[model samples]
Target chain A: MNIISFLNILLPFGYAVAVYAYGKAFFADTPWAKSSKRWILLSVIGTHIVYLAARTTAFSHPPATTVYEVLTLLAFTTSAAYYVIESRTGNRETGYFILNIPFFFQLVSSLFIKDLLEVPEILRSNYFGFHVTAALAGYSAITLSAVYGFLYLMLYHEIKQTRFGAVYRKLPSLENLERMSVMAIWLAFFFLAAAMLAGVVWLPQAFSDFSYADPKLIGTVFIWLLYGAALAARRSTRWKGRKMMIVAISGFVISIFSLTAVNMLLSGFHRFN
Target chain B: MNLLCLSISHHTAPVEVRERLWLSPEEIVKTLPETLRLGCSEAVLFSTCNRTELYAVTDGRLPHESLIRELIKQKNAGSVVHESHFSVYRGPEAAGHLFRVASGIESMVLGDVQILMQVKEGYQLAVNAGTAGFFLHHLFPSAFHTGKRSRTETTIGTGAVSVGYAAVELAERIFENLRKKTALVIGAGETAKLTAKHLRGKNIGSLTITNRTQNRADQLARVLECSTIPFDRFRESLADADIVIASVRVDTHILTADDVARALEHRHTGALFLVDIGVPRNIDPAAGKLENVFLYDIDTLTAMVDENVHKRRAQIPAVERIVADELHSLELWHASLQSTPTIQALTAMMETIRKGEVEKNINRFGEKDRELVELVTKRIVNKILHTPIAYMRNGHDAGPTERLLSVNVIRRIFGLDHDNAKRDDDA
Candidate 1:
């Protein structure tokens, strides 16, 4: 197999190994878990970069050209975001909970992922690349927010019920979890806002078929407004705590619906061939 | 292989019997010199409430009985301690036992990390008495290294082992950092005081103690250096506290569902950890149903503590692996003691011969050529010695007798004298 194909086959296993290592570190307290888990994750991200680069060079199109390639990019960006947050916060206890997302994304993408050496002229535009990168970054941040929100809710219930299990002992404090969730939401909002702006300015000039009322565009903008309002409400002291986490998690679900529903069920220019 | 251990531990003896052999650090220092006189070249005495073990490397005799008798005599418990109370380990097994002890695998509490420091102090005491050397110097440090490896490499020391600690552990799980959270302890009883003390030890932001008996509450607050709230008005301050510990002796629930709901609404905080360690139930069971209120009674806390203890027990094999790994390395080094002197002599004699031959030939060459010749000859010698040195350092897991025979065979083949081996070491 070519390097791109080889990495495509190898990518999911890399994440799976990272997932196992993080699990062992958090749950079983294995020796190699803590010292090497972060490096394992970083190596996977590095390998993924090589895979994306190889695919772009071989197929002569950026990774943003196909749904499968976009999934891999999403996986890459999500893990990279988690790594940055972990390094900055020095809170690695929640890595096990957070890593499952990228693992699932990469696993599915690797299975059905294709190599595209050539694409339509519009797909080659730098504007489309920036737009897709921004959108992927935003989606990755939302994934992180959802994971942290889910951990917060788990820890929240564990405490409320006085169940001092692994979730209770290994997770960060509720305040910290809530803070991280909000931070991810804020990041998602900014990236998505930029993606939408790029789309609005570049779409009409690039695609005669593009419409303002297209389902994917409208759904994405709608998801953006949903989080934007959540952040604004929290800023104004109207929403916080368990309720805010629920909203962030709900936002991820709706975004997933938009990604799948608008791309699969609805007819839209976002379903580029 | 000369190493030996005479141990009287809780596993082999009753507490009454074990305590008789206990020695203060000073007493251990005093007794260490006597151990060298017991046919041992080096000695270390480790004495605690759970165990009293004398580890020594004898020059010729085992003297396990004599060491036991001396320890019993030192404690004036000759009538109490019997031969059955002592477990003896010899050679690598002796090193392995000490490794287990240092790593807390042999501790009464499974992974008692405090035993590591105690073992460290025992080594220091032996050093102070000037009875620790060579084997012990390596052995004790290896034990310390084993202890460190076991702690860092396993989950043996991670969980809470007691109910009071478990309560605090639950709180820690909720609030990532307890330094900024306030604690409100209801009642000035011992349970309340202990839980309060644990909270204070963790450096909680503030503490407010309340009790029906105002005088008792004031006394406890003064002792703990915290403020006191009136028993009735304590409910008003509940919203300010992130952790509420209820150990008050009361007939009914001190905190009902309504009280918790109002607190959660008023606090504007994320969560509240309420630990009820009272004899009779103090906090309402219904309060645990509240969204942000976490209520843990004594039984639940005990259950969590039990689970943590089980987790620690499950880590025994992991710690044992560390002990085994360290013991193997120590045994290799100990085995080297047998063959190192011979290898050193061979290298020294070869160097002497090389220097002699170089001096004889130096007049035939210029300065640059002579230096080059010396370098080439040295490299040649090292290449020739590589196999022998590697074998002597670590070729296999050689027993003492095997190692002795190997070293003797090497010495005979190299024409190396035992005394000639000491020159380089002494230098």
Candidate 2:
């Protein structure tokens, strides 16, 4: 029996089980449910490691070519980001749902994208790899921020209706959610700035276009500007609580569309290859 | 139940009542026995500056007023009991109230921690007294677990909210090296003590404690490894102090802007951190506006606490889900207890009947030995209970007849009565 084939299938199956276990520990009323959640998280991380390793062996490159590779990478980075944040705060379970969202996107991408697509010669440069990797990491981090933003919105909505306000009691407090979102955004902003800079540095020599006038590039810059404004507002203690969350979410939404829909429709460097 | 929550809390009563009801360690030991003898099955008394609650679980199921009256009478006979400042809850309501209290839901600041551990300690005291029985044991543990789950699942306890913590955070934000700074804490009140403790934890050196009650100041100094100054010499010590936390409730200002300016003249240009936790503003507000002097009042800390409360309030759903899940698990176990005995008794009766029938059949084999007889009996019993046990184990025994017969059918069909066997399962 070939070990590589077995692991490729097993890892995704493990991810599914991990996701199910997460749901169980989060929702089910049992004695050792917490322990179960810890185990599930460990399993996901473990399986993801194996999955990445196998894909590396098969493709002979860092996993970021097709939609499947991008989705998996995105999910892994998102989950990893949340894991660090949650561990720091001792909120191991609140981030579980946020972490699993990428898995859904990955599963869909895996089903559609054919395996072993040939890499374009133009995309073979080291700058291409660096730019793509950084951008994906930035997007993943922003995705986590968006998750927190959604949680804040949900909490805000619930508090408005007195009867449904009980669930708000279960989440991290509004300030904590805001902080989590801001942290994610700021971290992503750093990576995004680096990625944009790398792309700019690569453009004149690699693509002969010095200006980042491409729709995807412009959209990313807009996101960067929006987040920079948010950071400045946060420092001044003005655009913090709810307003900050809404802006962060809107910026992330634009980034998402720019990277996916806009990239597909209009010509851009990063697209669903 | 005898649940008297005689509390001089931030709610129901003021700080004056709390101070009056506050019992020292010696007073607690003296009052415990009397409190217990007054029909209180268990008593856990908490006397903090924010609240002083006497949570007692008792065997009496009378009205809340009667319970309170009884508790007051019992406690009054031994020590002075302030009946006007008491609140009472009974049974489930009392349990739920305590749970909420421990969970920080009923806190004046809404999600201010420090109550849960106090509640745990109170429960432990009751346990140590051998007064905690079924209800108190289950209830207290549940309360503690709920509190743990709430903090773990949410960000209810985040941010530097308390005045002491805010002071530390601000200090760290400024100089970052508290080890070199001299922190002088004024007053021997709870706030001052807490602030000193926070400062001490940060490795601040050269602590100078000065209180109106010099002995109290001396005691605090000894405990915190700080130097105690006479209250009259406080102004003299302020010249070299890097950080001053004024926590006394003085009618008039202790450190005016002029005194602060003079102190600034004497002190280095590094920084002067002043935290005024006193309600009447121990340090002049204008003192903070001075060059190289940062001042914060009790309101600044209160605002931080409010903001944290807002954050924790948002985490309510996550905490609630955890509590609700645990409660459901408890209910499932409770339901399992209701049906388990019936299932066991029914299975046992079937085995007994099977053995009897096997013996009767073995009589036909008069020449057979005891080995054959035992083997045949085992086979027959297994055959009889196999289907029903399987169904019950698989959670498929759905019919009313099965439910009724599981308890009664085995008895009627096999002539198994209470005299044959007695149930050993109490739960």
TM-score of the first chain of model 1: 0.94
lDDT of 1 by residue, B282-400 (tens): 98899887766778899988888788889999999988888878877776676677787778888998899899999998899997798899998899899998988887777686755
- Each prediction's DockQ? 0.38, 0.03
TM-score of each model, in listed order: 0.76, 0.46
Docking class of 1: acceptable
User: On residues A97-159, what C-alpha lDDT tens digit does candidate 1 reach at each position?
Assistant: 888888888988999977665689888888988899899999999989999999999988877
Native contacts recovered, in order, as a fraction for each?
Answer: 0.61, 0.00
| Residue A156 alpha-carbon offset, candidate 1, angstroms | 4.3
Worst 10 residues of 2 chain B by lDDT: B392-401
Model 2 ranges off by over 4 Å: A1-4, A21-31, A122-125, A160-166, A203-211, A268-270, B1-427
**Looking at candidate 2, what TM-score does chain B attain?**
0.61
Off by over 4 Å in 1: A1-34, A47-62, A93-123, A154-177, A204-214, A232-241, A266-273, B1-43, B46-97, B152-155, B187-190, B197-232, B314-427
RMSD of each: 7.0, 11.6
